[model samples]
Target chain A: MDPLSLLRGLLDTTEDAARALVGRERIRLAVTGLSRAGKTVFLTSLIANLIAAGRGARTLPALSDATGGRIRRVFVVPAGTETVPRFDPEAHLGALAADPPRWPERTEDFSTLSIAIDVERRTSLGGLLPERRLTLDLIDYPGEWLLDLPMLRQDYATWSGETLARFRRGVRAAAAAEFLAFLDALPADAPAEDALAKRGYTLYRDALRACRDAHGLRFLQPGRFLNPGPRGEAPLLWFFPLPEGARGGLADLCARRYAAYLDDQRSTFLDPYFSRFHRQVVLVDVLGALHAGEEAFRDTGDALAAVASIISGANWLERLLGAAPTRVAFAATKADHVPTRARDALAALVEHIAFGARGRAAQSGAAVSCHAVAAVRCTEDAVARLEGQAVAAVRGVLLQDGRGATIYPGEVPMKPPEPDFWDAGLFTMPEFRPPRLDPAGTSGMPHLGLDALLAWLIGDLL
Target chain B: MSGRPTPRVILDEGTAPAPRLDFGWEVQVAPPVPPARGWSTMALIGLGAAVLVLGFSLLEAGNFVAAQFAQAAWLGWLTLAVATAGFGLVFVAIGRELRGYLALGTVDRARAAVARGDPAALRSALAAWQAGLPEGRAKPGDLGNMPINAACALVEAKTLAPIAQDAAALGRAAAVQAFAVTAVSPSPALDALVFGWRGIRLVRQVAALHGFRPGIAGTVSLLRRVAVDAATVAATDVAVDAAVRGLLSSRLAEHVAGEAAAGAVAARRMMLLARAADEACRVLPR
Candidate 1:
């Protein structure tokens, strides 16, 4: 470690920092969604289409300048990182290209995939200027995990009170009845013990599961409680919301554990990873929530509002470190579930549901856009005749029974469904299997609105 | 699903319905994939044939001049004067072909400057483009208000869009003319002659509209550069489409309808070439 060498090392670090401040070389795109909101499929399709674009077939038409000729080449290259596993698009693509063509497996942990886009920027000094390299560092994390970052703001008592209050309200009461009975039996000031903590954690988790799995709720929070990462259950996770009492025993113990949990997350997840996002995409399953009836729909709307604010209002730490996402895209995923004509209504519905949040995010200087996207088009538009008249419908291989079916899923309502809308119950939707794909991956997948999303995300750079 | 705020389902008061934001360019417009197709033997053959014809016509004129010299003196003098004028006219035509190259070069250099983003180049390109505007046009849509850089960036949208659009219209018209003449003409030779003339005429008109006046030879050169891909399409895919249409129409109508499909196939190629020519002439935002 000579003094000259050390100084040179410092200078090298300085140049790298300077480049990172303004260089458009490596851009991190953070993508997350709710549970089963199609996060894995979206990332996989995005990578596959880009790779195909390299070989002459590109479905990304909105990126006119890039796909038309400006892009010299595009390919998914393995990212070199030690912290997280390299994202394997091949495995996901293989699953979708399976004989029966199934959806890819859900994201279990964070992964990184790098796409190298060699762009010929003719705008500044056409042929004489060198080609620019843009590496799209795509960060894919479990949709169930991102929502937990927002939880760090609240302490154990505030969170406990809110959870208890939710349990006492509307449809949650019935879903959490067994949990509520268990809560009523335990005294808040009971002595701290491993068995008691485990019992409470199990009961509260079951309640969240019932609300989500059985009742089709969207926003069950402390998302780690639902999908507890690769480590499964650490000791700190064995805490649950409790009724108010003297703050001396069990309540104090749980509060300490909650603080420890937040500290662990802040070091391992927030600062190093989430804070580095240059752009963010929040995917919402609005159609699935709509199918769950009014209660679930409203619940989803609340979750989106919270997310919008969080996206726009990055904590002071993230902002100070220049990690606030400059642009945020709210995507209504699985758009192939609806007919093409009604796709607009589907976007409008989501917009109206979260209008306030979107406007605020935009005001806060994050370029916000809403889009209806189908990563892999699972259905084809068809005219289904009912009573000797034609109606808009989608025909696909239904996931329910591995058979082809045409379903007129009804007009996606322009605004939120009217009061008593559930009485008709006609807006129910079913999922579909992935479309067949080329085994060798030469042809790009047919998609809806992904080009628009990509264009908004990085069209200027191209 | 519980403890959510009471949902307020209401549209905006008196606000218009929001515009559709699902703009996927793939569905709205199919981008032109003009693959670089090198000059085929047919193109070379056409050029060679054209050169031979021109050579023979000049030789015939030479022979007439020689014949006049052997006739009566006054009649020979009159014949000599007419032949000399014809030779001068051919030279003048060649000069216009040179002018054609010059005019095309002016825009090409300015276009390169714009791409380079040189401030001086931007200003020069602006002046050159402004000078080329059609008479009585009201400043070509806000170019007068824009800064030089801004002007060049949106040169296509503000200045060249209308020109490109009109060029497209002309392309379509030429295509229709080709289709009509091909369908009605009794001979395949007539169809070929008419299509070639129409394509040449379109190239000249489109180039002239962008401020270049090329002679027949120059027009053909420009045509070759722009029409390479279209010619390939006509040779390959368009023929397939025409064949499909021909088969479908054969069951529906008699003799003439079958040729109409082939006519349409030729028209499709002409339209594609016209589009390429339009793009080839545009000045900025490359």
Candidate 2:
């Protein structure tokens, strides 16, 4: 085992020891989703609902009902957090509860919020029960970071071959043209140069960003290259995957740095959190994918498959890392964007995308479940008379002009849409502005199947 | 709920139902009494009161010592030393009891950790729990490379199952001894002394067998919980706990009368308590 891994293991054991000493129960929850998957809204709403539920708002009925009202109270741990920066619920909620009511900012880097829930369960005698607490440490990491997880098992040569091959594909080739041109000029046997490396890194990062922005392609490796985290534009993230059979000099330089990047990924990103958490919530923007078209949808599926693989496909490594989430809930976010009847189809589509990506991941005792959820509902389900026929519709403040408009947002499919469905032009996706919310989130934020998601995820603990 | 004017919805040139708010977006806020104060606040208040009481008592003792000095010098020094020693011993006893309570808590947390289904947690909790036992115990075969659920079940069976039997044996002996002694003691005082010793000894032996020997306060707490659990068990297990059932029911005229029946009840309670303690030690993480 790596010494860093051993050190992390030791740290985890020490913390567990401390908790054991105090007689406390703690469960870590990781929330990850691809770009524009509504991770921030999900987290903020989850915390708000927990606090709201405690305040008798009844926002989380699934959890409340599951424990039979055993949840006594829920409160955020004070800000003197040592492990990671605290995810401030007040600030996030303030953003949502702003004048016009907007969604919270997207997750930039991993931040944690520890919520202690006092669960009072009746003893065998069903009387005089002392309330036991379960501290939920909710962790939110940038969805971009998820792209780097698959790199752990791949060596520099293998990663280079794979990434370079991907760059040659249809739209990605056009996007990566400049970077590929630069790679052709920079000889493999040339002397190692910082300026050359920096040029290559910039072009590569730009290419990745272009792939994301232009074609809506989601699978870009070395995610921090595009969305450079706390270490902004550092030399450490200054290497790109080289072409196949390219070795020595500049290629050697890139390879060495690539090895270091993977090491950094293991030590900083993978080890600490994964060693602890037993539950995960993967938010997928299936509608966003569908709207972006087939390429983006398939890419989203690939990302979902990789995300689900964290629970099963990479079991040998996860077992080695000691980071298998026994239960995972894959949720298609922004359910209110679609009509009421299509929600089941939305759920099925995500399940197909996630489970169809990897078969045994769900069946291998992981208890994986899927749902169509709106973390913060921005639209109201409505039935509109369209062309003399009652059409299922949604009425909300349209994001474009900030006017209330009832729209037939379009049908959601139970699986990846066929060629005819797209050719027929079936989707009419207009974004919706968020509804006004209480600044304190005391009135409970509106959500679709969020309670079901919670029940599926952590109901047993509740 | 909002003060802002309702936004109007645009409808197509056709029949209209007028889009309205659905039940999915419904929100209601119930009036709730907050948990007035958490455990920490209550603990702080109790601690403050204890400090105040202790300080006042110390002041009175100091005055008494001064008064003794006025009466006699040697007697004053002796009283002061004895008082200091007594207070010092009391602090030590309190600290031990606190540690003991924390140990029992660790046991409870370990069980919870096992139930979480993390293999890492399973290994960690199992390692910690196993450490509590004395060395030279036989390590179980088929320990490596098994599913977490199977491992937990195996641990419960191989490791904890025999401990229960040992505990049950202790309980059986204590109950029989208590019934024999309490039923036929020459005097009430003698019976009380013997029964008290047996209860304490029985609990201590069972706790040690399970590798969770709690101190005075923890023992008392454990006993109280055991009593609660035992009562619950007795109420549920009507066929097995007939003596306890009879005690609760209005069918007293159907069974043995006087001190003998009381002895039987006490014995039954002891047996149930031992079982409860055993169950507490074994955390089944299914």
Candidate 3:
């Protein structure tokens, strides 16, 4: 065996033995989703509700320990890794606590927050077991960054060809027209020049931003181009894909930089985070995508599948050690936007989108599940008269105008949308402002199915 | 009648027209021009043919042209070279110019829509302008500022007052905390520290209303920049108040003032700067 594998084996054994001795284990939960998927709100509300539950407050009843009165205490603790920044729960919580409560900001970088939950356990023999402490470390990172994991296995030429091909189709083609023209104008065999490279990078970055912000496309690659980290604009990020059959100093330079980015992504970001995570929640704004259009919905599916592949493709060393068998959850967020009657169909749609990825994960000895949840419920279900018939709808204050309005958003299909669905008009998914909440309320944020999501995610561990 | 001498209205000679009171909004109408076609390509081909003909005639009459047989060979080669170069350049130039023209045309349309000052049209125009840029080189205009836009929209929609009230209550609580800390510790450093911490929290809360989250480093950088920006734009208290009013909605000024009142001079300036930076950074694309 290789020396590194041997070292990993030793570490796994040590960790397993330590858990067995103490009857306690640490669970690293990674929370990631594409932009506007309610990740920051989820983390903030999850922490608040958990803390509230431990304080004997009425929150998260579906969490067995909390409902059973078995949760003794839960409090935030210093994270295990000093190198990673601690998640600023106070900043997020404070934002939500403001008089006219508002949603927290979106996730930009990876942050960790560890909470120690002391729970009372019962033994198999029906005897009361000693109180156990489970440390749950939550990791929050931009879903955009997670989309770049697949690039680790692809070379510059392959990525460029694939990405450019995608850009040449449908809405992306129009959005990327200028950048594509710039690419066409460049000489394939020309010598590499920094001025030309910078121009290409800037134009490409702009195209990706426009696609994301304006068109709601989710499959933009090299995610850093959109969600640049602290050093996002450094020289390493100055590479753009060259056209196919490209050869010469320019192509060689781009290829080298692409390799360097992949290396940095692995060693600096992905490897460290993936190696430690025992559970992951892949948040998908399914309704938002469906509302965006057929093209966006399909792109979101592709993005989710890519995320699933990365999770299940653990290294051989990890497999052999039987350590951290990650359980993946594909959650369709903003279930409140859908009426109560349609949530199951929404979940079915989520399952359909993640069908291929879930199957792959299960085959790899990893558990996978799909759910539709609203981390913070912003609307209430109602029956509204539409076209002289009673239609199930949702009533909420519009985020844009803050005026109460009733929306009969179209029905969610139970299966993956077919080509025929695209021919029909897109569904209207209005943005709803968060409902007013007293900061001192027992429930941090009114949500639907969040308790069930929590129970499914960490119930067995507790 | 009560005053000893009633003030008589005096109009200067140049101001006698009283500004003409032109309330009629007039949009400029420009006659449409036909799109440029193959004129450029045709011109290039003509130039290339002239060059080809002139070159051959010169070669035929020059001292170096020893034989008439060589002239025919030179002319054939010269025509082929000129034709290929001329046509290639024309096609390439037209392709490029057309692409640029389309992109710029979209931006021009958006700018015209913005000039109309309709909110819905403005939003659409902004989206188009953002999408139409060659390199996303266009920065958000003054009206495109997110915080200012959101605040104005919320006020027009009757949503700002409630949010402002909540912010004011929160700000008051923060001010109370700052005062408590200052009263207990009598140290200027401790006072500055407390005020800075509260100021960051306040800014984060305000930014959340507009759906902006600047991380810790971003927030600090913004605070520093805001101070510099405020100093450059506002020299008096009235100017500072006006700047703050524009940045945060006017209704929220009370909250900012409360926070500023509880801190030292340096801390107050920092708070003011933080508020300015929060509004300025709102225009940045996430």
Q: Weakest 10 consecutive residues, lDDT, candidate 3 chain B? A: B20-29
- Span of ten consecutive residues with least summed lDDT in model 1 chain A: A121-130
Residue pairs in clash, model 1: A125-B116
Better of 2 and 3 by lDDT: 2
* Predicted candidate 1 versus true structure: per-residue lDDT over B1-286, tens digit per residue: 1222122111223433322122342333333466999889997999799689878877887787778777877777887788779878977887777777666665667765543334566566667767766675434454556666466556656657877788889989998888889889999998888887787788878886777776765676676656543432344554567575857575656464777677777787677767777766666533
Ranking by TM-score: 2, 1, 3
lDDT of 1 by residue, A54-92 (tens): 544556767754444677567766445567888878777
| Tens-digit per-residue lDDT, A1-462, candidate 2 | 567766775666567567645536677787878877888788888988887776555788887888787776777776683767777777888876665555555567778788988766546533343456778888777788888887877888898898998898878899999999998886667668888888889999999999887777788898888677776777888788888756657888888898888788778887766545667788888877776667777888887776555535535444344445667788999899878898999999998777654365564456678899999887877887645667777777655455567866555779887775554332436666677676656556778799888887888876
lDDT of 2 at A282: 81
Q: What is the DockQ of candidate 2?
A: 0.07
Q: lDDT for model 3, on a 0 to 1 scale?
A: 0.66
Worst 10 residues of 3 chain A by lDDT: A122-131
Task: Give candidate 3 misplaced runs (Cα > 4 Å).
Answer: A1-6, A65-68, A79-81, A124-129, A315-317, A323-326, A440-442, B1-286
Given the true complex, what DockQ would model 3 score? 0.00
The DockQ ranking, best first, is: 2, 1, 3
DockQ of each: 0.01, 0.07, 0.00
Model 3 CA lDDT for position B222: 50
* Model 3 Cα lDDT, one tens digit per residue, A16-116: 66985786777778786777888888887788777766654546778844336577667777546487778876677666555444676556777788888
- As for DockQ, the candidate ahead, 1 or 3, is 1
Q: Place model 3 in a CAPRI quality band.
A: incorrect
Q: What is the number of residue pairs that collide in model 1?
A: 1
